[model samples]
Target chain A: MTPASSMNAALERQPPRLMLADPILTMTGIEKSFGDVRALRGVDVTVYPGEVLGIVGESGSGKSTLLRMMNLEDMPDRGEYHLALPGQEDLNLFTLDRFSRRMLRARHIGIVYQNPHLGLRMNNTSSGNVAERLLMAGERSFAVLRARAKESLDASEFPISRMDARPSELSGGMQQRVQLAKAIALEPALLLLDEPTTGLDVSVQALVLDTLKRLQRERRITMVIVSHDLGVIRTMADRVMVMRNGDVVEQGLADQIFQDPQHEYTQQLVHAKL
Target chain B: MKLDQLTKPWEAFSYGFLDQSAKREMRRRILKAIAIPGYQVPYASREVPIARGWGTGGLQVTLTLLKPSSVVKVIDQGADDSVNASSIRKFLRRVSSARETLDTMEADVIQSRHRIPEEKLREDQILVLQVPNPEPLRPVQPDMSEARIMHGDADYGQLWLTLYEQLVRSGRIMQGSSYPSMVNGRHVMTPSPIPRWDVPKMHMAANLTILSAGREKRIHAVPPYTRVEPLVFDDVPYRIEDHADKTCYRSGVTGFFMNELPQDDGSSSFEVSDSQYGVKHIRRQEGEPVTLGETYYREGRLER
Candidate 1:
């Protein structure tokens, strides 16, 4: 093997650093309502760095809303969202203004939508889309943005040659890679994904999941992924939060959540997936 | 003319000329521009209470598109403090009480003429260029109908020929301001009055570039990463304008194109002038006594 390839192989084999000292994201008594439609009701969840936390729930269970609330995309009507920094207390994300929240999202948080199209700016090229969050964070130089974009695209296993190609020209899997490239580019502290592989084919799904796992490992990023697929959740999540009708029905280690689900909803979900 | 008869009718008719209907129509056009990305739409143009050649399009657009929180910056020729620049800046302050900025980096909405700012614009920032005309084919084909047809068919043969002729005459592309371009490689558009130096800056620019011609009643867009090529032949390629003497009196900015103001004595020697028509007098009065505090404060702030 070439020297570079051997080094890369060795790096991949090395165990990632365990930096799970404190919670990066903490949601307490989070309540959200859309004009009589209670999307979330007193949902409490915490996420730690170097950890993958899966949120599993059936349709209309408010799992998606819970994830959105964590990212500050959807503000809970009543709750304390304390986003933990390295040496700082959990910040109350809900109290901050819209602009500040958006800035925080751009700087510290990255979100991947269930539909990759929704996550990506379809009109821009792959590199442009990847560079967008960084641009929004006030990284203005074209050269710096381009270089970072190329690096991120390569890290995500996206074709660097197709960096100039727009989302419309790419396949679904390729577009998803662009979305992944965008999310991972910022090296965000918290990565919130809403059913990232819902619409993808099984073969494509496996590839995307593998890439995501590898990225999470490399970056030591804290993740909150909402998915109904128990198998995917088991594969990717270190811990699991099972929600039903906006409330977290159960929370435990991934192995425990699957092997011995305490909640009836979690059990039914597992059975249904099986 | 009897005073009683004139006074009685004047009161009723005086308020009638203050028709906000035209402003409403411009607002509708601005909305349509947002809804239909990259589609140039025409509206009933109004002569904004500002100068004709001076940022009237940008002023009208700003007036129509302003939200309460919008931070605005107006640059004429490229610098922020030119005479025409201050006039529009003052007008926006009077009309909307929107926050005004001199820093190109800080502005949420920049209304510019002749140049894009040297600073790179952010995605949230929207650039409104004051356009003399929106049709890129205007120089090549004067007929509006023919221009539209050419744009509809993507026939840019005449545009290519014009560049080819420039090459034959000057050995390089001579076209400067109002550089012709293809928006999204679909619709022919203009980059307004910015120099050829700033023309290449528009290619795949991060910010949304919007052009408005208040007199022409048209609005067009160049979405981010859109191909914005200046017409050039292979043998004689497109060249950016060079500024050997790059200097900004106030900002200490160098290597940017500066306007030359002819002295009143009719001397051939040209003094550095701001991009806008009127602000040279202020700069002259301020003189080389660089008030370091003012410069520092202005630099600290962002332009809108």
Candidate 2:
């Protein structure tokens, strides 16, 4: 059976009512508009827990917009969005107010922007930036904050000795790692990544990609990564969604999308990458 | 308009020149600052009659702690009667009805700019130091938010590098005042532009030191019994000013810090920087009934 068929068969095996149950996120008819332009047009996405879902598209394709929506940084003009947290009922993210959304973002969502400068505070020490997230999570103990900061840095392979140095003093790859450390410090259930290694050197990108893949596997984190780079998706994501002009053109298992493309836009993407 | 609704009561001015709410906020921040020994606590620094940069931070702390029974001493560069010091002292007294004293030993709370008193402060005393720049990392990292993060991380690599460069460029470290010193083995604080000699006095001292920068909007504390070590390389030891042996010309006091009066002939006359200390010494010489407290330094050497 084809990978797409297999995915459908797996879904069919589960109870019909429980199909959307315990997913990391569920979005239906998500529509966003900027001025007269449609940023996202009727986008629907469902992410399973512990799965890495890659959304691939060029600029203005609404990939970043979709990721931002997941992060709760931006609200769609119209849509139903539900975030299923572990040991809790599905959170109606769209219905919550701003402060509640902020609390949810701090507690359960971690977003890594394309630009390190946008994602991380350049002057804060690596560990400090991480501790900030912990502070937002209502951690008051300095000793505990320091310990957790150090632990997360160590886990991300960030040099413990350099924890005190600001982001401006670090290399680009190291800065990204610091951002990762900060994002993961609170142990968020959902990780939203926006072109995480877009500006790094090829070798550095490889290393960062490897670290990210390893981290996702080890932590069993549910991730929605948006990138224009096909290689990034092929390496890190288990499933792939192709977007063009604010709409998903096609989506399937990573291997299926690479080996056999059902849609013309996806075929062009695969062809362009090769 | 009803008189009772118009105002609570016809008062000359608020106590301590700050309303109750302002004092309460300051007290809350002060407690947090003391709890996290060297950490810079951000507070809603209220506006007073004084300008933002001129000892407003120290004034706020003093006002928050002031009572009718409190004895306050205000000093500028060790002189108790300088324009800045006397003005602050007058303001403190006028607003709070607190007694003002020139003698360091008699004062319950001492508000100072750029210098610690020559005399050792008792445990009951609280030293409010007016800081122009509170960030020790400003020279290395210019951004305040970034500097704060650096403080959180305990990442001070660039600070050491700057010192190393200073030693290489000039045979000695060129840092003059506001010597960067580590507090409680965790935070590096700018000890309020006080000379190197005064910096050491904060190290495991009996009195609580509150360094507040009104312009920068940050307050940090060096609590009693906390370690405050001036940053230095292993090979190059931290040195106090060479004025150790320079005697005060007017009072004949040889061990204390001195202010130089430049003469036309290129020779500079040195006077005791702590004006009150010198006054006490001169009074005692004239056979007046005056008692001097134990000083931090004795005979040009800092006593441990």
Candidate 3:
């Protein structure tokens, strides 16, 4: 069987979300515009715990913009973005003061970008890239930092020998692995990936995706992944949301959405993949 | 030039070389600087006989604090006899009529250019450091107003990124002097031009340290018993100079910051950077009635 067929088989065998808590994220009526162009128009999303929610769309579909909003990288023009984690204070992402927003982002959220350069500090060593967030979170002891960085790098299946190697010196796939290592270093509660494997070679993409899948399973982190690749969304995400022209066209379980897509855009996307 | 002509004129200048109003303004600004810990308070930097960039910042503060009975010691790059240090010392004494001493332990106020005195400063003492550049963010940011905003926002990511880049490029941090440190958990400060060896001495130190830049017209303080942490990565530890293992050739002081002197054979001999401290050690070894205060570093290691 081809890798695509194998991915479908794995998708069929995947388990359902393990728990049903209060939605970790509650965003409604989210709207964003740049000058005359509306990047998002009344987007609403509710994410439960321990579920991989994949956002798939064509270019300029506001997929990346929505992921950015989810991670608080950008503020929607009009929306109520609340984070209601277990036993934690409900954080209004838009209304928080700068310091509190920073603390919330640092402690709970992790983001991996489409390009590794945007995520990893190119000049910093692989371990330093992983430990940078830890340092910013007020971690001081070298021993503790090295041990924790080692654990994350090991989980990402990165070679321990390259711990001191800078990201600029690494290959594209290795750079992406370093980005993954850095993002998951603190074992964050929420992981947001924006076209994380889009820029890598096909073979390299497989390795990175495999590493990401293993990480998501081992950590059971709530994830919001944005990609145009249906195979990626199919093999990984439990639930899928398809977007077109700054709106979520359809959202449902991964199997139902792919097997019997309702929206024209989503059907065209699925058929194009075949 | 007749002696009688020169003797005809008698001038009355303000005490401590600064006018009453200037001193009062400085006093108010100093208090604010101390209260805010690492926040730089701008002041009207006045002119003095010394040049603007050369220990003038330290001189202004020393002049403001001096009284008839206040004992003062001054050092430049750890030397008590340097031209800048001695001139500032003499100028301070001449104007305020304060007592002058080279010994660090005997001073009420210690004005220094580049190094912290080797001896531990007491609670009664105040250290006035001459800061050439008060802004630690200046390396990453050149715009003063924007730098101020970053300071207000407690945004030090660029400064930390510089260190991170240095670690990767050089295999070690290349900041030889003027180490960037976080003061009291809020402000990232450049602790004057003191070596990395002396940066740790300011952490929760007993004495109050005021860093003033005359050219820049900014003064910031590290109040007594405040945290002064050097900006460092956790995995890449902060390392001091390798001078700990070398002994001073002149004073036989083994565990202090040192100056290297090139010899005829191309070998370098070490001497204690704190000139007066070394003299006291030599005097004590020669059976003179001398008292040596406890040093910040002992046996080539910093005492916690």
Q: Please state the error at residue A246 of candidate 2 in Å.
A: 2.4
Candidate 2 ranges with C-alpha deviation above 4 Å? A1-21, A87-90, A94-103, A121-174, A201-203, B1-73, B86-101, B104-304
In model 2 chain A, the worst 10-residue window by lDDT is A7-16
DockQ of candidate 2 relative to the true structure:
0.03
Q: Candidate 1 — which residues are off by over 4 angstroms?
A: A1-20, A87-90, B1-304
lDDT (10s digit) by residue, model 3, range B109-162: 999989999889999999999999999999778999999988988878767767
TM-score of chain A of each: 0.90, 0.91, 0.91
TM-score of every candidate relative to the true structure: 0.54, 0.56, 0.81
Q: Give the least accurate 10-residue stretch of model 2 chain B, judged by summed lDDT.
A: B160-169
State which candidate has the highest TM-score. 3
Better of 1 and 3 by TM-score: 3
Select the stronger candidate by lDDT from 1 and 2: 2
**In candidate 1, residue B109 scores what lDDT?**
85
Docking class of 2: incorrect
DockQ of 1: 0.01
- Residue lDDT tens for model 2, A12-95: 122223224466678877899999999888887878878888999889999988888888889999988888776766767988
Model 1, range B4-111, lDDT digits (tens) per residue?
Answer: 867754443112122467667766777776555556788776666766666677777777666657788998776687788888888787767678977666678888
- lDDT of each residue in A140-221, candidate 1, tens digit only: 4455767898999998899888887878899888888888888888888888888988888999999999999998887888
For candidate 1, give the lDDT of residue B172. Answer: 64
Q: Candidate 3 clashing pairs?
A: none
